[model samples]
Structure formats: C-alpha cells, structure tokens
Target: MPPPSPSPSGRLQWADVPPPLRARLETTLGAPVTEAVTPSGGFGHQLAAALRLAGGRRVFVKAAPDDEPLTAANLHEAAALDALPPYAPAPDLLGVHRTAGWTAVVIAHLDGPDPDLSPASGDVEQTWALLDSLTAAPAPASYVAAVSAAPSAAGLLHGWKELRDDPPDDLAPAARSHLPRLAELEAAWPALATGDRVVHGDLRADNMVRDHDRGVTFVDWAHATTGPACVDAASLAPQLVLTGHAPADVARLLLDHPATAGSPDTTTAFLAALTGHWHRNARRPAPPGAPGLRDYQHRAAAAGLALLNHRLS
Candidate 1:
C-alpha cells in the first residue's frame, strides 16, 4: 500500500543530515557516500535512505534526531533487529551510530520493493510465509516481552473502556451502540495476548519488503514484542480489508489458518479492541511532529470496524 501522506516529522532527505553526523557515518562505513536515495515507505524515521558508497557497496540507514521524541523508538528498532533469530527474514544489522544529536542504524540493503498487499496480489502468500518463519522462532531472550513494551496490546487494547468513559462526538453509530459489550470484550485482551511466540506487534504493509530470493523481509522492529503468535497473523486481517479483501473473506481466511484456528471469539474481540483503539486515537489531536497520523488511524479504524462488524454479525 502507498504510505499514508507525509507528516511534518516525516523523513529527511540526504542533504538534510548535519555535518558532524554525516562525517561519523562515512567514517563507520569506511568510505564516502556517493549517492543517497530516500526510501518511499515508513513514517517513523526522520532520516531514512539507501546510501551507495564509491566502490558499489550500499546500505540502508534509518535515523532520528537526538532531540526528536522518536529517538528512543529508533534505538529500540536497532536493538530488536540485532536480537532477531537467525531464521527470521530481516535485514542484517551492519551497525548502530549514536552521537550527541542523532541515532541511526545501518542495515544491509535488500533489493526489493515493499510487498503489494492489495487483493489478488501474489505477494500475500509471500507475506504469509514471512510471518510463518517469524513466529516459528521463539522471541529473543534479550528483547522485552510484548506485555512489557510501551505499545503493549494489554495497554492499548482498552480503548472501549476509554470510549465509554469519554465518548467522542464522531464515534460511529454502530460502535456507539455496542460500547458496553465492546468494553467487556476488550477486557479479555490480556489473557488472549499471552503466548510463547514473538509478535511483530506492528505488522502493516509499510513494514514489509519483498525480496525475489528471500521472499519477504520485515523491517521496523521498534514494536517487536513477545506475545500470541496468532496476534501477528490476526493483525493482518484488517490490513487485508484495507487493501480490497472482503471482510468476511478475510475472516474466513484467518479462521482457516492453523495459527488462528479455535480462537474465533478471541480474534473477534481483538478486532473489536483494535477498532476502538484506532477510532479513539483518530479522534484525538495529532501528536507533535506527526500531522498525518490521525488520518492514517482513521482509515485503519474504519478497516478494523468493518472486519469486526462482519465477525460480530
């Protein structure tokens, strides 16, 4: 999917780099960058690009300003990439660079475009394969468990309760009518999220790249967490809908998967919780430096609500 519109805190071009940080990066690479191309997808980084050195070597770099609020997220991604299991489909971490005013990760450049998740795309199956490989491995011991992370499902999935306490004027009529039951259903997330497998936590289209030889390589690990393996597969349901899959078809596809079998109730509840979560956030004021986030959340909320409605009916 084409990334949501650029945000004020969106990516910085190659020329925007400060002199000191640029020098440090070149030193670490052992050569001066001959070319820098800003990557098209992703919203989290202030600086994201593919850098080519004089001798034909290339690396992917993602960075954030030290004073920017997302510096912690960048650092966490570096740690998560370093901690991934050997079999996981992800870029190799070359190095991490931290200075007084910047934090960046250098990764082996993968040669492929982001997967096209739209309906009828063959890339869907490739993405499924990627998720299979990812969840088959146990979470790295060095990384924090999903429940302990900042965006833990246990923490963010309580949107129905929050909405019940302070309903937004723009809340959908269908959602508003089901508030009480939704709140009750959302309360089960903590139990549902408990599992031995590690979840990508944030498994959207923009976070995936399709390599001809490697199948798919997942990127942006700031939200990596240990939780129900099914959560990652389940998380893709709404994304499928967003990309033109019928909600009912998406539900059936997920239900047939081994990862999601025998847990229809939990899956429905999780979808409902996600619906409320995105809806609530979509109505709030945009965070500093993230002007396009609310719109993206709104679109995501609508997709989740559509799937939830299909499951509920």
Candidate 2:
C-alpha cells in the first residue's frame, strides 16, 4: 500500500499547471484539476503537483523543466518504478509525457507524512529493515554503474579549489588545513565490488518517510544506483544519529562493516572528506554549538580522523 502523503499547502504556479500542458493532462487524466504547486527540491528544475483528477483520484504529478539530463532521469525513474514491486513505499509511476522541452511523470501519491529527522527520532531499526528489503531486490549492471558515477564530494572539492572563493575565516583555516587530507582521502577509493546491491545515493531523512508502524518508505530515486552495500551503509549510518540512534553505535556499525573496515587512516580521511563536503555546501548556519546536521558532520569527521590518527600512532 502507498505510505502516507505529505501535507499539502500553498497555491499553484505556472509550472504546476502551465496552459500548454494543462489541457493535455486534464484530458488524459480524465479529472478536474483543482490545485497544483511545486514540491520542494529535486534534480534540475523539478516540480510536483497534487491534483484532483477525474473519478476523485488524488494523483501526484512530477514535472521536469525542459532539459536533456532531467528528461532522462524522469524516464529512468519511471523504469525503476516499473521494475520494483510494491514492497518499499515509492511514488508509483502513473504515466509519462514528453514535450518539446519538458518531461513529466504522473504517479500515485504515497499517503504519509515526511519522516521526522529531529534528534529525538529513533527509527534506525525501521529504516534499516526497509533498506534490507530494498537490497534484497535484484540490481542490474547498468544501474550499478550509473550510481557509482554519481557526483562525489571529492569532485566538488576540486571545483571549489578551482573557484578559490574565500570561505568564512573560521571555516577557511580548518578547510584549508584539511584540503591535502581531503585530496588524500579522495585518492584512496575503497573497493566496492563485493556486492551488487541497489543503493540510494541520497537517503537522508527528508527523502524518506515512516509509516504508522514506523515502516520506511524511501523516495527520490534520482540518486538510486547499483553500488557496494557498504557505501549505502556508510551513507545511512550518519543519518541514524539524527533519527535518534546513538552516534557511537552508528559509527561502530559503519566502521565494523567489511567494506568500510579498512585502515583507520583511509576510513578517517574518507569520512572527514565526506562530511566536510556536505558541511561546506549543504548545511545552513545556525547558533554556535547548536546541534544539527553540520555539527554531526564535524563530529563524524573528528571520529574518523581520531581512528586514523590512532592507527598511525
């Protein structure tokens, strides 16, 4: 069954119901459209609309702005949806429409709220259970290669160096100090060839939801790719803390994993670079010492670094 849908709010926009496309959608969906609006973020210019179609079917529509790569992902997502069964709660692909400059996928809305990511959240067991179910599915060769090719923090750091923008004085010193180490970490790409698991490259809390029994429904397959099971484990380990798992436990599990269980130095450098990358780009500033994703990233870096340093000693 579809998980709960997100709460609807605000007004519709041109992107949600452009004149050129509205007629086609109404005719095809066979429903009166009463409302539409852009959902939050997605790759490129993406918007999701909730519409009351004919026969009282409440359908969700995802539209991508006219572009090459965006069109591809929309089609790709539709295919992935088709391949996977109804087990893990993902948006159901209803239909695909391609225009001169745009591509859109109509899908059945999952009926649930976004999973809370607050510190009090304690749903790791649930999250991991869902992950297990997802991994149990067969992954194709192309899917694995595409996910492995997804943009990495190492690549972004290289771009940042090229741009030479002045980071905040407080941040610059640490970032500058870590630049070499980051490069070193980037060089030591661990072997991820042990498994053929389908992975969600970006499985943060916002992109996931929990059901009435705390069952998980991971959304946003743009980052879904075939890769090492450990990569997914490492990516999700940090999130456990935000969802109420003890950070220590999360770190231990990720560290103990065979794929990630390597030299302390390599692990430290990898974790540091990963968190540093996110902190540098994604996190918003807040009160000093306030706990949030940024703080957690810093701490993960420190812990990984400490493990590395100890091994070196």
Candidate 3:
C-alpha cells in the first residue's frame, strides 16, 4: 500500500544550489556529475538530491548553509552514520564536506520506495525487526562520546507541558478536553529515557525507503540519538494511525511489539508528549522554507491524539 497521504516536499533542489558548492561536490567525488534528481518525499532539509556520477555511482546528498539551522542536523547525521556499528541498518556515509559556506552530507543512495505502512503490510514486521536488532546492539563508545551532551529522545519528545502552559485554540476536541491529563502523563516522560540503545529519534515512513529483496533502508538520521529502544518503536505508532490502522490497533501493535512490549512507559506518556509536540508546532506559522511540515504535524497530532485516547480508554 502507498502512504495514506503524501506531504508536500518543499525544499531546496539541485538546480538551486550555488555554483561554487556544486563544483566542490563534484571535485570531492573526483567525477563529473551525470544527473541529479530530488526525492519524492521529505521536507526537512534545505537541499536533498541523488547525484549520479559519470563513473556510475549514485549518492544521496543533503546540504544547508553553515548559518542555517538544518546545517547542525546535517552534521549530527554524519556523526550518527559514522558512529553506528556496521551491523546497523542505516546507509553508509559516503562523505562529509564543508565548502563554499555550505555543510553537506553524502550517503549511498537507497534504491526503492518507502515501505508500505498499512495495517496489513509485511513491512511493519521488517520495520520492527530492524528496530529490535538496533535496540539490542550495544551503542559504540565513539557514538556515546560524540553525542554525550546532546539531547536524548526523552528531552526532545516533551511538548505537552508547553501546550498546557498556553493551550492552543485549534487543538482537537479530545486533546483540548484532556489537556491536563496529557500534561500530567507527559511529565513522566523522562522516566522512560535510557542511554542503553540507539534510537532513530524520529522514526516515520518518510524517513525510509525499501527493496523487497533486501529489506528496508532507513534514511535521515538527523534526529538519531541514544535512548531506550521503546522510544524508537513509540515514534512510529503515530504514523501507523496516519496510515490505515485504527488508534486501538496502533496501541495494541506497540504494546505487543518486541521492541516495546516490556516497556509500558513507551505507550501512554510517550504518545501524549509526541501528540503535543505535533499539535503545538502545527499551530505555529510555517517556517521560511519548509512548507507542508505544519500540515504533516497537524495530521500526526490528530492521529496521535486518537491513539492516546484509545489507550486512555
């Protein structure tokens, strides 16, 4: 099945990259560029595209100006890609370069469509299988040191309290009514954090692409961090709701998944906090370059609230 809804991917294209930066990329690869194609999904990065070299190698590159906010995330992704153990399922980092005032990350281009996230799709099993393995693998010492001071999933996932401080007028009726309870549950969010496992701090369909013969390849490690394995699985639950699954089904799926089953802390509280994050951000005006992001967040917020309400029931 295809995605339930496709979000607008308004981002910097290859044609828009400065000539100086473009020349630097080709020079770094030691090959003349053949073609560059923008991806069909995602809206976070400043510039994202797959560059094919004359020598027949294709690499995916994402870049932003050094002063741009996304440049930091591009750097963090390079670190995560390098820091992860070889056993991890992420793409290989091809190169990291800072040239012409732009920070760019290049990785081996993934070769298929994003896995179908519908309720009955087998991709869900493969998705969790990867996460189960990821959670079980010991985080590398280098990775630990690299992100030593960076925020974990726990710290970044909190938003309910913020919404509580200044509730937005457009919240879903259920979310608006349960604001106090959601905030109370979200306060317990920190309890779920742990540094024992690697987490794709933001896990969702748009961040993945798949090949049936080889399984799925996860992309966009910008939000990658160390946290309890359950948090990674928890991140995908809201997205499932955006697909075809009912809120109750999504809840049961997480409550039963190996990566999350044992961790009750992964359910109600995490979902509430995630919902608040989307709802709060969705209310804000769209950022300068990334359009459709707020709408994606808004849809995710509603889906998250539905699942949260089901769990609360």
lDDT of each: 0.76, 0.54, 0.79
Ranking by TM-score: 3, 1, 2
lDDT of 3 by residue, 56-165 (tens): 98889998778877888888888888888877778888888887777789888888888899988999888878988888866888877666556655656667777778
Off by over 4 Å in 3: 1-9, 165-169
TM-score of each: 0.88, 0.68, 0.90
The weakest ten consecutive residues by lDDT in model 1 span 1-10
Stretches > 4 Å off in candidate 1? 1-9, 140-153
RMSD of candidate 3 to the truth, in angstroms, is 5.1
- Report the C-alpha lDDT of model 1 over 22-128, residue by residue, as the tens digit: 88999999999999987666655477789999899989988777877667776767777777778777788899888747787888888788888988899888777
- Cα lDDT tens digits, model 2, 1-313, are 2321233332224344345566777778886677664544332234565676556677777665554465566666666665555564576678887663556788766555667655455565566666666666567655544445444323442212321355545444445555555555544544323346676657776676564543567766765655455555566666655455566666666566554564344445445445555545433574322224456555544443333333223
| lDDT of candidate model 2 versus the reference | 0.54
Please tell me which predicted candidate would have the highest TM-score against the true structure: 3
Model 1: pairs clashing at backbone N, Cα or C within 3 Å: 146-226
User: How many residue pairs clash in model 2?
Assistant: 10
| Clashing residue pairs in candidate 2 (N, C-alpha, C atoms within 3 angstroms) | 3-111, 4-111, 4-112, 5-111, 5-112, 31-53, 31-54, 66-101, 121-243, 144-226
Q: Global CA lDDT of candidate 3, please? A: 0.79
